[model samples]
Target: MAILFSRRKITAWCVAALASLAACGAFVPAHAENLDAPLVLVVGYAPGGSTDRMARLIAERLSPKLGVPVTVENRPGEGGRLAAKQIKRAPAGENVLMLGNPAVMVVAPLVFKDLGYDPDKDFVPVSQVSSYDFALAVGNKLQLDRAMFLVGRLWAHPEEAVFGVPATGSLPHFFGLMVGDALSVQPQIKGYGGSAPLAADLSGGSLPIAIDTMDSLYAQHVAGKIRILAVSGKKRASFAPNVPTFREAGMKIDADGWNTFFAPSTMPQPKVQLLATKIREVMQDPGLQKAADALYITPVVSTAAETAQMLKAYRQQWEPVVRRSGFAP
Candidate 1:
C-alpha cells in the first residue's frame, strides 16, 4: 500500500511535529521538547587538558537531564579562538558552546593583536568556573627563607631575578609579570611549552622561581620537592590553608586566572538560560564536587547573566593591572 499526502498536508504534518516538541517542553524558557538537534560542547583546548576534562565532566551529567544526546568536540589552536569561531558559525538554534580560559578571553589579546574573535562581542558567558590559584615556587637551595620571603628579597636584590612560565600569555607568565610590577622590578621570565618542562627546569635550578597554579604544583608541594611562598587566590586554599594569599600579603594582585564556558553570541536568551541553569545544577552535585577535587579543580556554578556581569567587572579590574605591568595591546 502506498502512503502519500498532498504538499499542504505534508507541510502541516511537519509544523505539527515541531509544535508537539514545543508543547512537550524540552528546549527553553518554556522547556519545550524537540527532536531537532543534539547538544554539542566544544572545547578550546586539546584533549587531556583541564578544560577538556571539565567539559566532559559537565556534559556527562547534563546529557540525560537535558534529554538530548550531548557531544564533545575538540577544535584546538589559536588559544581557543578556533573553537570560539566554530561556535559562532553554528546555527543559532543548535546547542553549541565552548569551554575557555583567560588566555583566550583576556591575556592573548593583550599580547597578540590579530586574534580573530572578540570575547565581548562574539560569545556569551554561560558559567564562570573557579579561578586557578597560583603558587610561587622556588628551588630548595635558594637563599631566601621561604617562597614568600624569597619573592620580597628577590625584588630587593640589585639584579633582576628570573622566573619560569608555561607560555608567553599563559597565566604563569602574566602572573609573574604582575608580581614583578607590584614589586617595582621587571623580572626575567622563561616560557616553557607546558608544566612538565617547567618542572624540569625548576628541579634543575635553571629556573629558580615559577608561578604555576596550585593544581599543577600540589603534588610536588606535598612531596616537599618544591617550596610554595604565596598564592594568587583571595583566600588560602583548602589543601594549603597555611599559605597566604596575595591579598593577605598586602600586595592586592588579584589576578587569579579563570575559566568560563561560553556559547555563540546569537544563542537565544531562553536557550542560554536553560543551558546555564543545567550547568549550575550539575556543578552543585556532590559527586561532581568530589570528582573535581580529585582532579585538583574546584567547581564553580553561576547563571549566565551573573557570568556576564563578572566578566564586565573583571575586564575593568584587569585594565589597571595590565597597564601597571606595562602590558600594551
Candidate 2:
C-alpha cells in the first residue's frame, strides 16, 4: 500500500531526521561549520615596523594550522589609539585580533585624556608574544667607555647632557626619566618625531646620549658607532648579553617592553580560548621561533589568564613611574 503525506507532515519528518543526525554528531549548521572566514591581525603601526612584522609572522604560521586565511591589517594613527578603537568595535566573532605593546595597552590610557577605547573594558587578553628592554646608549663621539663617566658628566654639566627620546610619553621617555632620577640628575628629554632622526643625531654626536630599545640601537652599538651603557630590565637582553641591566649598574629600576594579543571584549570565551590555543601552538613552531630570534625577540606562549596577570602586574609596576615623569601626553 502507498501512503500520501501532507506538506506539514513532510516538514516535521525532515526536522526530526535532522535532529537525530545532530544528536549523533553527524550534522552542523552551515554558518557554524564554515571556517573559511579570513582572520585579521590588526597592527597599529605602518607596514615594516616591528609590530607589523610580528603580526605578519604570526598570520603566516597560524593560517595553515587553523585551516583558514589569516592576514595582517595596519591601522596606524594616533600612536595606535585608532587601531585599539577599531579592535574594540570589531564584530562579535573570533576573526580579529591586535598586536599591541605597552604604549597602546598601558601607557596610552594614562597619557591621552580622550582615548577612544578603555583597555580594561574594551579588550580581552589573548596572549603575550615577546618582550625586550630599553638601552641607555651614547654616541661614540662622546668617547665614554664607562656608564659612570656619563653619569659624572651629567652631574657636572647637566646642561650639556641632554637626553633624546623617540617621542614624548613613550617608553623611552619614561625610562629616560627613571635613569635620570637614578643618577640624581633631572632629565632634559627632547622628543623627536621618530627614532630614525634620533638615531641619526645620536650617531653624529649632536645627541650625546639617548634611551631606546635594544632592537633599535643594537646594530649601531655593534658597529662601534654607539656605546650601550646599560639595559633597563632585570636580565640582560639576549641580543646584547654583554650589557648589564640597570639594577646591576646600581639603579633600582626595571622596565621591559612587551607585545600582546587582544580580542574584542565581546568575543565568546570559547572562541577566545580556541584562538589563544592556536596562537600558543603557532609560537611553538620551530621556524617561527627561528624567525623571532633573528628579530631579537624572545617568543613566549601564554594562556589568557596568564596574560591578564602579566598585564596587571605591568600596570602596577609602571603607573608610579609614569606619574612621576609628569608627562602630559
Candidate 3:
C-alpha cells in the first residue's frame, strides 16, 4: 500500500519546524534590538503623492517606537516594481523594509511578465497599514447618481467610458476591472505615469471619467475641476457622505487600495511576528489615526497570518476580474 500525506499534515510539520527554530532564537524576533540598523521604507511614487505621504507618516511614527532610525526611500518608477526589487535584494536580517501595495503585490506581476519577485512567495507580509477607497470622477458631462447608481449607468452605457488611471496595473486599474465586472460594460481604461498627467488629460476633456482616490476626487470635485459619480468603498466616505457605496446602489461591489509592509520571504517567523505585532500596535495609535484621516486614509490592522489570508482571498476575488479586463500578460 502507498503512503499518503494530507496537505494539513504537511503544513503542521512546517509550522512545528518554524516554531522550534524560533525558540532557538534562530529567527529574528519582531522586536529585535538593532537600533542602529536603518529601517528603509521604500515607496513606489514621488514624494508628494498620497502613497508616499502615508509611507512617510508611518516611518515617522514608527521610528521612536521601534528605537530605530526609520527613513522613507523613494524609488518611484515602473509602477513600484523598482522598489519591490530593491527590497528583495536586501540581505536577510537587514533593516530594509518595503511598503507593499495592491500594485506591487497584486496587479503589477499580472501585467509585467519580467517582474523579478513574487509578492506572495518572495515576501512575508507584516501587517496591513492603511486603506483608501477609489472614486469614479466624471466631468459633469452627464448627470449621474452618487456611488452605486453611477456604476449601474456606466454598465448600462453602450460607449466605452474612459477611466483615467495612475499606472497600468495600479489601484484605479483594478477598480475599473471591478466596475466592468459589476456592470458588464468593459470600461476603456487609460494609464498615466502620474497624477499630473492624468489630471491634465481629464481636465482637457480627453478623458471623460477618472477612477482615482477619494482625496484626489474630493479636492478636484470641490474645485469644480471634476465631478464624482461613484465610489468603491463599502460605506459612504466621511468627506463625501452623499456618495453611496456599491452596496447601497444595489450593486454588490466594494474594494480599496491598501498599504502593507513586506520583508523578504526568507525572514524568520519570529521576526515576522514581531514586526506584525508592532505594526498593529502603531496602527492603533490615536496620533496615527488623526494623521491618516487628514489624508483620507483609515488605519487597518491585521496579524501576519491574517494578512496572508486576506491576500489569498483578494487574489481569488480579483483573478477573474483581471482576466476579463483583457489583462493577458
Candidate 4:
C-alpha cells in the first residue's frame, strides 16, 4: 500500500528540507526538487567552441558539489543573444544558467537598438571564469613581426585594409577598427561565422590579417601556422609572453575580454550568492586550470560585485571608440 501525505504535512516537509539546505550554506529550490528540474548550464555557442568547453568544465565539477544532475545546453544564434533570451524566460527558482561574454553582455547593448532584453535587469552575474586579450594575426603571405609594420603597410596600401573579425560587435571587431583608425586607413572587416574559418583563412593566405581573442588563435599561432603581430592588452598575454603588446609596439591600442557565468534575474539573492561561491570553488580545481592554460586563457574567479565593475570598465573604455567608429545595428 502507498502512503499519502496531507497538504499540511507536505508543506511542513518542504520547509524543513529548505532549512536543512540553508543550515549548510547550500541552496536548491524546494520546488525544483519536487519537480526534478535538473541544473542546466547554457552555452550560447556551438559545441566544441571555447564557451562550450568552459561550460562543460564547470558542469563536471559543480554537479557533485551541488548534489544535483547537471547538463550543458547549446543554444547558438545571434552571437549569444538566443541563449540570453532563453535564460530570461526561465521560470523563477529554476536552475538555468548561461556563460556570458562581452558580445552578449556588453557590446550588443551598446550597438543594437532593440536587444529584446537588458542584461543587467534580466540576468545576475554569478562569477567570472576567465579572461583574455585581443590579438591581430597575419597570414603566411605577410612577413611582419610587429604591429607597427602592419600599420605602415596598411597606411601605404589601403587595398590591404581588409581584415577578419569573429563577430560584428565583438571586442575583436572594435579593436580591429581601433587599429585601423590608428593606421589612418579605411578598414574593411569581414565577419565570419566562427574563429575556425577565420583562422583557416589566415593560414591559407586568403585573408591577410585577422583580429580575434588570443584564445581563438592560440593553437594556430603556437603551430607556427600564422603570425600574431601584436596583442591588444596592457601587457603581453601570460601564455604567450614572447609576443609584444600593442602598447609595446607603440600603437596605443589596448583591451581586455572576459567570460562570466550568469543566471536569470528571478533567481533569489541567496541562491545567486550560493551559486557564485560554488563557481569560485570549481574554478580553483587544478584540472580546470590546466585545461584553461592549454587553451591560452587565464582562469579567474571574481565575485558578482567585481564582475559588475569589470563590465562597467569595459563599457567605459569602448563606448567612445565605438561611437567614433559610427557602427550601427
Candidate 5:
C-alpha cells in the first residue's frame, strides 16, 4: 500500500531520516571532514625556476608526511600575483596553498595599486621554507673590477652607469636604486622579463651591471663570465665566502630573499597548524637540506608564529627602502 503525507509531515520525516543517518555515522557535511583531499602547492613562476624547484621538493616530501597526494601547480604571471590571487579565491577546504616570496607577498602590496589580494588580510603564513641573498655583479664584458670603483664611475658619469634587473619593481631594482642613492647618482634602470636574458646580456657584455639573486648569478660567476662585487647580507654567503658583503664593501645594505608557505586566511586554525607542522617537519629532513644546499638555498624551518613575525619585520625593513626608490606599478 502507498501512503501520502502532508508537506509538513514530509518535511519532519526527512529531518528524522537525516538525524537517524547522522546517528548511524552516515552523514558527511559538504565541507570535508578529513584531510584526505589532494593538496596543491602553487608556484608563482613557471617551471625551472627556483620557487618551482623548491615547491616540487617540498611537495614530494610533504605528500608522505600528510598521507595525501601533493602536486605543484604553476600559475606564472604578474610577478606572482596570479598564483597568489588564485590561492586567495580557492575554496576553504580545498587544501590549496602558495609558495610566496617578497615579490608577491612584500613588494606587490607597495607597488601594485590594484593588487587582487592583501598579504596581511588574505593569507596566513604557514612556515618559512628557504632563504638566499642578492649580489651586485659586473659582467665580464665590463671594464670595471671593484664595486667602489663602479660607484666612483657612477658619480663621474651617471648617464653611463645603467643597471639591469630581472623586473621592474623587483627587490633587485629597488636595491639598485638604493645603491644609486647611497652613492648619490641617478642611473637608468633596465627591466627584463626574467633573469635569463639579463644574465645573457650581462655575460655577453652588453649589460655591464646586473643586480640579481646569488643563485641566479652564481653559475655565471663560476664560469668566469661575471664578477660578483658584493653580496647583500650581514655575513658573506657560504657558497661565496670570498665575496664580501655590501656592508664590508662600505655600503650599509643588507637584504635577504626568502620563500615561505602561505594558506588562505579562511582556513581553520587546526588545519593551519597541521599544515605548518608538516611543512616544518619535511624541511628538517637531512636529505632535503642536502638538496637545498646544492641549489644554493638555505633551508629554514620556521614555525607559523615565527614566519608571521619574520614577514612583519621584513615588511618594516623594506618599506622605507621601497618608498625611497619611488617606484609604482
Candidate 6:
C-alpha cells in the first residue's frame, strides 16, 4: 500500500509539473515562444517608396503567421545609410530589421570614404525579399526607341550623353557608366534627389537620359511621357517585354539590384533562422506574389547562406567595376 501510494504521488507530481509548464508556456512551440515580442520592420526610405511599400507588405503578411504584431518604421535618410546605422547599433534582443538595398548595402560602402557603418561586421543578411533591374530611359524629346539609335545620337553629339541617376555613386550611377563604356561614349552623369524628381525631369524633357529601376520609370513610360530604351538585365523584363535588355540591345552592361532584410550580426543564429523561415513563408503567399508582381519586383526565397553568397558575389563583381570607375561620392 505504501509503494502504491508513493507511485501515485510521483505520477501526480509529474502531471502537476507539466501542467504548470504548459501554463507558463515552457512546452509551447519554439516559434511561438521565441516570437513573444512584436517585430518592427524598418525601412530606410521615405513613405510610398518601393522599399517602404515592400516593408509594409511583408509586415502585414508576417503578422498573422507569427501571431505577433509587425510594424514598419521609416527612417529615411542618406539613401538608407541612416537607418542601417541605427540597425547596426540595435540591441540583440530588439526585434528590429531593415529592408536594405544596393545603394546603401553595396554602393555606399564602396564609394563613401567616411561611411560610418561596416555592413560585413555589423549586419547579417536575413533573406533577400526581391530583385529588380535598372533601365535607361529617355525623354520624349529624343523620340528614340532603340538602343542603337540612342547610342548613335549620343556618340555623334557627345554633349547630349548627359544622364541622370537617383544618387551619385549608386548602382544606377555605375550602371550608367557601364552603358557609357559599352557604347564608347562618356556620359555626363547627374545625381538627383530621388527617382521622383528624376522622372519628373525626364518627363519634362529637362533630362535627356536617366537610369533607374524599371518600376520607377514604368508608369511614366506607359503614359507616353518617357520611353524606356533598355533594361540592365540578361533578358527582357516581363513588365516591359517590348523593351530590350542591354545585352539584347548589343550592350555589354548587365546589372541588377535586390532589397534584402538585414539584422544585426549579434542576433542569435536560431533567431535569425526562425525569422528568415517565417519571412520566406510569407513571401511565398500567393497574395504577396501578386502584390510583388504589381510592384514590378520578383518575389525571392533564399536561405541566409544563399543571401550571404549573393552579397559576396556582388562584392566580387563590383570591386573591379568600382576601381575602374574611380568615382568619389
lDDT of 3 at 13: 100
Task: Write the residue-wise lDDT of candidate 2 on 54-141 in tens digits.
Answer: 8888999889877889989999998888999888987674489999999998888987889989999999999998888898999978
**How many angstroms is residue 210 displaced in model 2 relative to the true structure, after the best TM-score fit?**
0.3
Give the poorly placed runs of model 3, Cα more than 4 Å off.
Answer: 1-36, 145-157, 203-206
Q: CA lDDT, every prediction?
A: 0.75, 0.85, 0.75, 0.83, 0.85, 0.85
lDDT, candidate 4, 1-329, per-residue tens: 99998999999999999888755546655334222347889998889877888888888888877777789999999888988988998877588888989888878887889888899899988899988888888987898877788888888889989889976666788888888877678788789877888998889988889999998887898898999988887877778999998888888678888889998988767777777877888899999899888878788878888887887788888888888777776
lDDT by residue (tens digit), candidate 5, 122-229: 999999999888889998766676788777777778887788999888888887877777778786889998789999999998999999889999988988999999
Cα lDDT tens digits for candidate 3, 272-329 = 6766777788788889788888787777877878888888888887766676666744
Which ten contiguous residues of candidate 5 have the minimum total lDDT? 25-34
* TM-scores of all candidate predictions against the true structure: 0.85, 0.87, 0.83, 0.84, 0.85, 0.87
Each prediction's RMSD to truth: 5.9, 5.4, 8.5, 6.4, 6.7, 4.6
lDDT of 5 at 157: 80
Question: Which residue pairs in candidate 2 have backbone atoms (N, alpha carbon, C) closer than 3 angstroms, thus clashing?
Answer: none
Tens-digit lDDT string for candidate 6 (67-181): 8899999998887899988899987667888899877888888788888899899999999998888999999998898988998888889988888998777788888887888
Clashing pairs in 6: none
Better of 3 and 5 by TM-score: 5
In the predicted model 3, the residue pairs found to clash are 28-271, 30-274, 30-275
| Of 2 and 3, the candidate ranking higher by TM-score | 2
Off by over 4 Å in 6: 1-34
lDDT of 1 by residue, 51-133 (tens): 78888888898887778888888888777877776777766666788888877787666666677777778888998865578
Report model 2's TM-score to 2 decimal places.
Answer: 0.87
